[model samples]
Target chain A: MLSSTVENYLKSLFLLDPRGEKEVATGELAKSLEVTPGSATSMIKTLAQAGLVEHRPHYGVRLTSQGRTLAVHVVRRHRIVELFLVNVLGMDWSEVHEEAEQLEHVVSDEVITRMDDLLGHPSHDPHGDPIPSADGTLPTRTLQTLSFCNEGDNVSIARIGNQNTEFLKFAEDNGLLLGRTITIKNKNEIADSITITTHEKEVVLGLAAAGKIEVEHV
Target chain B: MLSSTVENYLKSLFLLDPRGEKEVATGELAKSLEVTPGSATSMIKTLAQAGLVEHRPHYGVRLTSQGRTLAVHVVRRHRIVELFLVNVLGMDWSEVHEEAEQLEHVVSDEVITRMDDLLGHPSHDPHGDPIPSADGTLPTRTLQTLSFCNEGDNVSIARIGNQNTEFLKFAEDNGLLLGRTITIKNKNEIADSITITTHEKEVVLGLAAAGKIEVEHV
Candidate 1:
């Protein structure tokens, strides 16, 4: 019976090591969890003692198989709940993520399964992030950030690297939504800006913002 | 913002003083919360300092108007979530109370409002317990325990005073569900049992169990 805080730490570790192949730095986990590096180290130690994580003292920490399994289930609950809140409850997509953060810890697996069935077993959430299946299978999709594409290339939005509600709203307002086709118009490397044309409308995104928007070739 | 523990304490106080007119004994509150009397007293003191309850040492404690308002909202959330779990998710009625206990503390008001609308502003839950309105107005209806009804009287089950799943399952197994009409066949006062007939089947219940079931004259 893991506390929600412990579940959250495990989730952060899972997200940081999506491929489950590398040890993540304490600083990175701290930044992702919005906690101090000292706090992250303490929590990492606790998780290691519980056999959920392995702490490589001078390096960082990585999830054990047990930790990864628990983390996947938590992610599954989060994505399924987010989809239900938006599709069934008609909640704003930008807002549902925050609500799901609290709900994912409390809803039973039975409820999540019912929600998955109700939503017709969606493969991805509204943000285009893959929902880990009940059996812990994550989707393998080849995607590149918009910042990495050639100026003349055309691509479709796949997912946003950021989950911030403000960032999501900004993308939505500019028609940078998932599955929207966009042609790269110009790239000013020195200025750190990328210009794209979507549906006869042109929008300029900062290099940092463009890097956050992942895309696939059209 | 009150922690769920504080909220639970407040809710217990509210339920113990349904009429909002009397001070409930500390021992009774302790029993209701399943805590020791000393712990109940300590918590009552904390609640009193927060201005949510008034403590009368050697007597009891009562909810302040502020406490009652918050307690009613928590009740609204609990009943609405229970109805949603059973009605929308197709969960068993006997199972939803436990699930709702966890959900009520986490679901946001926005989500609850959506559920209320989806359920068409239901006034009563599946158990016939009145759901407090969003504005905190609890329905006023006179109801009495089945143990108080006279032998030969006909009544319809209104609400079950107990939320224990086992007790509910026992009632369901005996066809003693909410809204079921039954006629009192006999009352054995010394033996502490009441016999009732429902749908041509007769069932005998001890006074303790009968007292947990509220009914209305049909």
Candidate 2:
């Protein structure tokens, strides 16, 4: 089993440059890890030796195919655990991120398989992130950012952004998660908030929040 | 927050020497972690510095008051995660251990509290191990060994001694688990097979399998 620190490094690297074909800057990785350049330097070298990463010092790092596989596995585990926390454990939507982050690295394929079964083989998590299929194929999506839509356009939420809790609470409070309709009641440019009616409640989403969310034309 | 690896070390120490509060021997820890003595020594030093453990060379390690509190938290998380996997995720009872082991370190107090609520604050996990309450109190009970049970003794599984799939299959085939009730019908002293009636199934539990089970007489 990989250490949490190692996995975190790999996850960050994968997120920055998922396919080994792209090279990430070393300083960027160091910044993302919140570690000194020296520590990141040593660990990246180690990961390269392990064949989990391909690092070219100044040019940065990328996950090898083996490493990408592992990163996706971790991401799938994170999303599955998050959904389980919300849909099954009854956790508040605002609270699943930190918990899932911690759990994603520890659960095994056996546990994940069972989780998938328990969730009725859900195609998406409670937050609208796609749940990778059994074979690790993520469902391809064609979603648009709500901020880019015209003022009167009707849209449906396709995915919620994986950011902080305030955003999640705002989204949940508005019932603007996946498969929910947003009528784009109004866009307030002065205050930079968008008004949308959902589940019979009016939500004033900040332009920043609306920008983060992905939507599809209705 | 302690990492799962660190939490596992603390929990292992807690379980290995629950009564006396004696220091855990390095050799014993190495055995449990499946690492070398030198590796264990190095890690213990790190743990001691981190204030999670106290170490004396020949004497085994022990948890400080702070460490004990952390261990209790990990235990709470593990039991909650296990219950969530089973009750919510629809994961098989046999598959929850590793997942719980990883998740125990990362879940938040909010998630744990809510999980307890969703489960109606279950007092025990699927393995019949008492779950520590939100306040960290474990219900005291004297559990018995199934191997030593006499004829007509009604027993419920407390914890499976091992997590091998073979054990799970056997338990599943016979409808035996943490809450299963069993009445010992006959014990073959020669062939070492015990005939037991569980629910409506008359099953023969081999000595090897029966020996690995811990039970409680009701």
**Best candidate per TM-score, number?**
1
Off by over 4 Å in 1: none
**Least accurate 10 contiguous residues by lDDT in model 2 chain B:** B13-22
* Candidate 1 lDDT over residue span A1-218, tens digit each: 88999999999999988888899999999998899999999999999999999999979899999999999999999999998998999987888888899998999989999999999999999888899999999987989999998889999999888889999898888898889999999999999999999995899999999999999997
lDDT of 2 by residue, A112-192 (tens): 787777788888887777777767678767788887777788888888776588878867766777788877788878888
**Highest DockQ against the true fold, candidate:** 1
Quality of model 1 by C-alpha lDDT: 0.92
The local lDDT score (0 to 100) that residue B33 gets in candidate 1 is 83
Candidate 2 residues lying further than 4 Å off, grouped into runs, are: A1-10, A13-23, A27-66, A171-180, A183-209, B21-30, B35-65, B90-93, B147-218
Q: TM-score of candidate 2 restricted to chain B?
A: 0.87
Per-structure clash totals for the candidates: 0, 5
TM-score for predicted model 1 compared with the true structure: 0.95
Error of 1 at A165 (Å): 1.3
